[model samples]
Target: MGTWIIDAIATRHDRSGFSCGQPSLDEFLQTRVSQYQRRNLGQTFVAVPQGEDANNHRVIGYYTLAASAVAFQNLPLVRSRRLPKHPVPVVLLARLAVDRAHQRKGLGEGLLLDALQRTQAIATELGIYAVEVDAIDDSVAAFYTRYGFAPLLDQPRHLFLPIETIDRAIDAAS
Candidate 1:
């Protein structure tokens, strides 16, 4: 939380020291982020460390978002009842990771809120049924649940929160 800004990944930032305690996540951020960006497969945002200190300017955390869908049949039985009998539209929070050095300082939560806020703004004209994510593990799943996401009836590790419901909550909070 020291002078830092969460923004799109840029060429000038260093990503060599980001280790979120998860090897896969760390590897992805270090190696594959640029390829994904180049292919238009996903849009990744970085939590860029800022301030007067030159050494602190690095990508400490990041998350990727992409257009995706969930098959109607894959939804929880109780939750799918009102949806169309087809693939439900969604925005996938494909990956989320915060550097281990930066953990417990609210960076993960901040990145998530940023992603959701961006999604909320885009939902204005897009037909997003919900925001979805395939949880990396149970711990990650629990973290998202705390933000109002619920597991898919069929896939316990998968979760989502309806756009309408999120909007309502945001309106209420404001």
Candidate 2:
């Protein structure tokens, strides 16, 4: 229930104790995340208890982002109509998970908003058209739908939120 700070994953953050009720996700955080960052495959960020030092920072939640693309044909008709036929660039929300102990504390939503904000910033320098995610289950898909993500016409589990939509939301908030 303490305050949390989100930042890029650091080598010293204690990731070994993280368990999000998903073994694959746990393993990724504990083992593969640094490799992903080192290879430029993805950028992973972690949420840790506020005030923790370099040696004591314990990851409470984490998410990863990667540059990607989606075929125009895969987009929903409404979103695709005005776009070109070629693949559209995107930022993939490759993975998102919260530790079991911290599951109901709103960290997940905070992590999502953080990811969306980061995507919006990246779009200014890159040609990212949207933020995309492949939901691991129906419940997960519903979680995203509550936040304005729309499913791809050809793949219901594949959801996307257009950068333009995020831009408008950010502007309105401002």
Candidate 3:
């Protein structure tokens, strides 16, 4: 097992080995981190490292969270009926990727739980309605589903976990 530390992308040094061995993701991270650093729309991108060392600080995985808007009409049936007929402030869980080397060691789950906990804390302060994510593929969608995320619509790969639901889960876990 390894210790995983979650921190802002701004504080972390740029390391090439952080790539999950995927050419597209590597290119995207390389290009976006350079071109869009600190943009409000790009604030969600975050990097996770294995430990304190910068040189050998293998990037196990990363995720992004940002302020987003969601229409009530597009939400899941259970959630839509409960919310007001207006746009809601949402924490967008944009992208989550784990390196191939760290895939099965629960690092991905740790990153997700960290994001959820952070979202919960932020929601407490800023009054967000839910944590929303757009899954990159069916497999990713299924992973979120297992964690209680529900689809908003029939397509476009969007899903959400209401803050209340998260609260309930936390309570249940305790």
Query: Against the correct fold, how does model 1 do in TM-score?
Result: 0.91
Q: Which residue pairs show backbone clashes in model 2?
A: none
Could you tell me the lDDT of residue 168 within candidate 3? 89
- Please write out the lDDT profile of model 3 over residues 1-174, one tens digit for every residue: 246776667535554666665676666565675455556565544445555577544456777777898887887676777678998789998778877877878887877887888888888789899899988779888999999998887565798888989888877877
In candidate 1, position 30 carries an lDDT of 89
Point out where model 3 deviates above 4 Å.
Answer: 21-24, 44-56, 154-156
Residue 138 in candidate 3 has what lDDT? 92
How big is the positional error of residue 172 in model 3, measured in Å on the Cα after superposition?
Answer: 3.4
The digit string of per-residue lDDT tens for model 1 on 1-174 reads: 345688887676688988898899989888999999999999999888667355546888899999999889888877788777999999999999988888889889889888888889989978898999999899999999999999886688899988877788778878
TM-score order, best first, reads: 2, 1, 3
Could you tell me every candidate's TM-score relative to the true structure? Answer: 0.91, 0.96, 0.85
How many clashes in each structure?
A: 1, 0, 2
Error of 2 at 80 (Å): 1.1
**TM-score head-to-head 2 vs 3, winner:** 2
**Residue pairs in clash, model 1:** 76-153
**Which scores higher on lDDT, 1 or 3?**
1
Point to the candidate with the largest lDDT. 2
**Scored by CA lDDT, what does every candidate get?**
0.86, 0.92, 0.75
